[model samples]
Target: MLKISEVCCEDEYDSMKNYEKTPVLMKRAPFWSGAAVQNAKLVNISMKDFINKYMVLIFYPYDFTIVCPSELIQFSDRFEEFQDLDSELIAVSTDSQYTHLAWTTTPRQNGGLGGMNIPILSDKNHRISKRYGVLDEELGVPHKAIFIIDNKQILRHVSTSDMAISRSVDEVLRVIKACQFVDKYGNVCPMRSPCDDDTCESKNTKDND
Candidate 1:
């Protein structure tokens, strides 16, 4: 197995066409996840499973890295916050399950995931990351990508950022809240949304600017 410092070679799936893909409702996402046993423990992570709720997928390039750990821990820290909003968060990368397990067992002070229980999907072949169009062929890793899938499994929001910058978990939650708000009220959610949450107030200022 290759270590984190080793760069990956370019492969067949290095096309830009797959990025920002919009999936049809009830369609199964093209990837396998969960603990990788000898047979690869694939989860039934279909669009149908998350009905009447929301789904958030964060795609990072590799595991046991700097920005990645910070982002994953933050999501794990706020896992219940997402749950409270009837949403699920799934983190993915091009690393294998064994790699994920090793990293998760490592502590945050040691630059690891600090034993986060959030489902970290393994895409060792970059098949899933490429299908979602988050892979970076040059670096052989996925981009800092965040995707919001609605309860019906339709791909609603897709955005990417530099790997050097860690994403704001609060921003992600705010967007999901807005998505939910729109679904229920059928009107645009104000940037501030009248919510008393600290994230709401701070994010609103940025939203307006």
Candidate 2:
């Protein structure tokens, strides 16, 4: 997997830096006692499933939309990579489970994500999205938001982008790995490399006027 620096361009890196510092409160992942897609019964999806495990929570704009399917399929194709890192992928939208099932059952040629192993959580009431501050009240759909929650249920990383742009799956995996590295080593990250001359290393480093 590519490092976070390679995955994100300079502008994206600056944006992510600001985003990381923003104080946005995230609600705990909901425990839903509802039916999963394809007639699979689900009592609830708890934080425990992700507590000790790395997790990627993806909140899309909406289902059955123009850009949604492409992003979904891209994530599905790389799902194994996430699994290799011992992370669970939970995709959420305001769409109902019936809609999720229909989309999953539909062929990829027909713009549906066929046979996706990742769990698609329903936020039909907008409760979850609202809690995450991704809900677009006017459109009633979620904006593109991704959260990397560590094993302890603490919000480690959060990002939201325009509805049009699809997120980088590789970068998401990298962040998860970085977070896991931090968790294991306490402070130092194996992937944190020395800054180059052009990069600022301290808060006191001033840009040349």
Candidate 3:
């Protein structure tokens, strides 16, 4: 396995690209790693770290953009909701970790993300984005996309949108709930409504102690 390091050589990247196949629904997600800015510090993060828990990868076009901050901050504010559901949200962009940190330090009033609750992953090499097939060849940035990986590392859901559009975090949460419901109960979840306590645990219900 090609573990992500602070400075992955180009040869390593090529080997990874060739070694790993493209991501497919209901299949294991492609393993990836890179530097991430979390809580004002740079850290090495990888898909391996998120194993045994649901991982939500949110790939946005860029930092300091109009719709990007809104989506990021919303996810950050509602991070506990995801945590309650046994999931982690990771925000990724082509921007460098330093840029991610700078944007985090900037206030929302001035169009900054403001100390995000989730780790902001830097896809500066563009390899991770490309491996996921969200990279825009023309724009040199990723399209707004979300990949939900289950505890078993199987990709359960994926959504992609153009740069002009922003994703619905609530909808993502509902989908996650539905995914969990299906996994736990082996029943079909309704399209519009989330699985309630009658069929499965309520979204508000925290994990049992």
Candidate 4:
């Protein structure tokens, strides 16, 4: 497990902390006013369409890379699991749509994803990544980040990993399940008995009638 401190330097850590507490109203997802990706054909994703739907926006450093393919293939193979949870997955990269299309058409046996079912959005201008604060300006590539948005379009969870490490798909599913459980139950489900925690003295208290 990569510790938070290991993932970010001190300055980055401070900036992230400030970003968390800052009271800025985020411009909602699907912020395109007029200019959208060409081809309406390029993944053809629109924010309005995804509103009121659970979404997972995953960013990779770039395409046609070794570690990236492994992760992308696994995610694509398990894409149906996400759909079963009422969530849509969209992968993003700093590469242009042209690159994405070319790669998608290439055969997986030849090291390409090959007719992937999911939409691979192009962040060629880096606008979306900058908005999400995941762009690495120095490298001109996005940090590996995953954003989980609820049906309300609120950003519920954010997880980022270093370029070399791949995130666990199981953990992603667990988070979605946890979020859904909370949404339905109005409280977080305890993984174990409350009495298991020594600090939870209230668990042992008896009601006096």
Candidate 5:
């Protein structure tokens, strides 16, 4: 079996100094808005609009970079899996929306993003990255970070990595499934216990669907 990825508390809640961890855990996620390019269209979107849905905010360093494009395209390819599980996935970068569209429209053979199914949000001003605590101040780009917000708008999980490391799409899927399982059954998920694992009685039966 593949090992599940581990996330650090510091990476998850770096901005929560002087506050109780419990309260911080229950606090609503910070609100944000920016232009996004999705399915070859540009539009305005906000975090508030995704209320009542599981929201995954993926923060990467930049567009037109090697590691970033693979991650974005992977997530875009598996986007419907998130939707099927009642979640929304959004990719955020400091790149402008116009750049996002250009990259998506560019052919993959030319080392471009070809096509992207999910929204790629523009955080060109870095406000959202700063608020999320993923900004690399010296570099003016965010660290590789993933924030999973539950239906109530409470942030449930967060993971961050340095530029050299890439995140696992499979691991992210397992996490959201675990979150949903716990939310439905009120049972705790042990470490490495994926929702589909037979050992976990809390596993959802409909998971095979």
Candidate 6:
């Protein structure tokens, strides 16, 4: 297991404070993106460089598997909606770029990604997975994890699931919307079930009670 303590250097805050334990959202991590079957290309995308909008990096164990493709496809299906809100969705795994390319070329019925518009990053080194604290100790691979980073380069949210269970893109979108709402209005979003309709704009923040 990757310890958070090992990754921490020095944290900056609005005020100077001494702390033995590292505070979350104060450290920057780098990740590689652009590893898609459509293109066997790799580009270094650092969290430090992203200034505005949000990023959703969903990590799965590997490519060409039972659950990974569906998750990637589902996100890809809803790609433009996220883009309209100024968000980028990235699927990641500890697989080689060649494997990723092959899987994307294969058809979905044939148990491959077929083709996904969103960037499927190849974290062959597992550096981002470990840095984000989602690395599986035994297999030395990433578990099902989704990291939501704000435009300010701060990690805003994290959700993880087991290998057998697939994740919900709707839930991830809801969280991202909530984060955006709060960031914009400075009010917490109401605790409600994710709305299936396009009325996400009507969400209201809870008032003092």
Q: Tell me, by lDDT, which candidate is best.
A: 3
Local distance difference test, each candidate: 0.68, 0.66, 0.83, 0.67, 0.80, 0.67
For each candidate, give its TM-score against the true structure: 0.73, 0.72, 0.85, 0.74, 0.82, 0.74
lDDT of 5 by residue, 1-209 (tens): 11112212334544646332212444667666889998889999876567678899999887888888888889999999999988999999999999999999999888789888889999998878877878887999888989998887778898888889989999998999888877866767656655555645434554454
Candidate 4 stretches greater than 4 Å from native: 1-43, 192-209
* lDDT of each residue in 85-118, candidate 1, tens digit only: 9898888888877887778777778877765646
Count steric clashes of candidate 1.
Answer: 0
Give the Å error, residue 144, model 4: 0.2
Tens-place lDDT digits, model 6, residues 148-176: 87665567887778899978878888888
The clash tally of candidate 3 reads 0
After aligning candidate 6 to the native by TM-score, how far in Å is the CA of 119 from where it should be?
0.6
Candidate 4 local distance difference test against the native = 0.67
Top candidate, metric TM-score: 3
Please list the Cα RMSD from the true structure of every candidate, rounded to 1 decimal place: 10.3, 11.4, 5.7, 9.9, 8.2, 7.4
Which candidate would rank higher by TM-score, 5 or 6? 5
Query: Better model by lDDT, 2 or 3?
Result: 3
Quantify how close model 5 is to the true structure by its C-alpha RMSD in Å: 8.2
Score candidate 5 by TM-score against the native: 0.82
Q: After superposition, how far is residue 163 of candidate 5 from its true place, in Å?
A: 0.5
Give the alpha carbon lDDT tens digit for every residue of 39-142 in model 3.
Answer: 98899988877767899999998898888999899999999999999999999999999999999999889989887899999999888888888888788898
Assess candidate 6 and give its TM-score to the true structure. Answer: 0.74
Ranking by lDDT: 3, 5, 1, 6, 4, 2
**Which one wins by TM-score: 3 or 5?**
3
